[model samples]
Target: MFGIKFFLLVTLPFVLRFILAFSTFAPVAAWPVWSGIKPRNSRLATVAEFFNLKDRKMAVDASVWVRAMHGDKSAFKILSERCESDVRLTEKIYWKLLPFVSRLERYGA
Candidate 1:
């Protein structure tokens, strides 16, 4: 969970917008996000499963993403710790920004 202060009042803020872009459990096995605009897939769970399937790189990134989504405020710090070795900031940011960009395109400015 996270909080934001407004007018000196502390308010716990839940993430109101989150999108899991793709999953293996979707009805259409060959499509991304069931061809919907912004559907929530079982992405973290799928990634966890990927680890078992030997996709190390995607699994590692998804593990960090799962932690962050599940209220681990230090998840980003953990990712930074793996900077040069396991993760690239640009790639992570690009993936993270995708959902927001999609929303912008579907909606208006």
Candidate 2:
């Protein structure tokens, strides 16, 4: 019983980490939460890096979101171009960026 516990304790984290590291699946959605209200700091500056995916459209959308989070409005233009190239990408991107889209509309950005 002790040996089984030791094995699981040592190996479980490694197994889970490996699966997450290699997984190609993107989350259904992601959002940039406020990091803090520190002086001289932007509210949404410290955002997570977007995932790199194998699918071209998804990859582009992820990249665009990362850029957008960094205050680059041109990222949306690239996303739109990708959507124009593939109609299906529009639906996928819409869901993926729903939170950010709402924020943009709210702020009139």
Candidate 3:
């Protein structure tokens, strides 16, 4: 009977304290309330779009160019070679526009 009383005195407080501690932390352990919040800016949306798997190829190309521009020669070389054909095409179109713009300016003058 004395051992039983001693056990209750020692273990009961610990068990109650444990339960209280867990209950106190229960709300914190539950899902975060801020998890559903999203940014109102379109830039965040664009970043999410850039991370999509469907845009992996473009993302890789853009990342390479960004790395190269940041002084990574190897990355730049890889990006430049990968985009060389498209870059040249764009340059051609841009150069062609220059002469037409000059002609327009001369006519306007």
Lowest lDDT sum, 10 consecutive residues, model 1, at 10-19
TM per prediction: 0.20, 0.23, 0.23
Candidates sorted by lDDT, descending order?
Answer: 2, 3, 1
- Candidate 1 residue lDDT tens string, 13-60: 111111232332212212232233222343543433322332233235
11-107 per-residue lDDT for model 3 (tens digits): 5445433433333232221222222112233242242332231221223556777788799989977866657644554454344223223122245
**All candidates' lDDT scores?**
0.40, 0.42, 0.41
Note each model's CA RMSD in angstroms. Answer: 16.0, 13.3, 24.6
- Point out where model 1 deviates above 4 Å: 1-61, 86-109
Higher-scoring candidate on TM-score, 1 or 3: 3
The worst-scoring run of ten residues by lDDT in candidate 3 lies at 29-38
Q: In model 2, how large is the Cα lDDT of residue 1?
A: 47
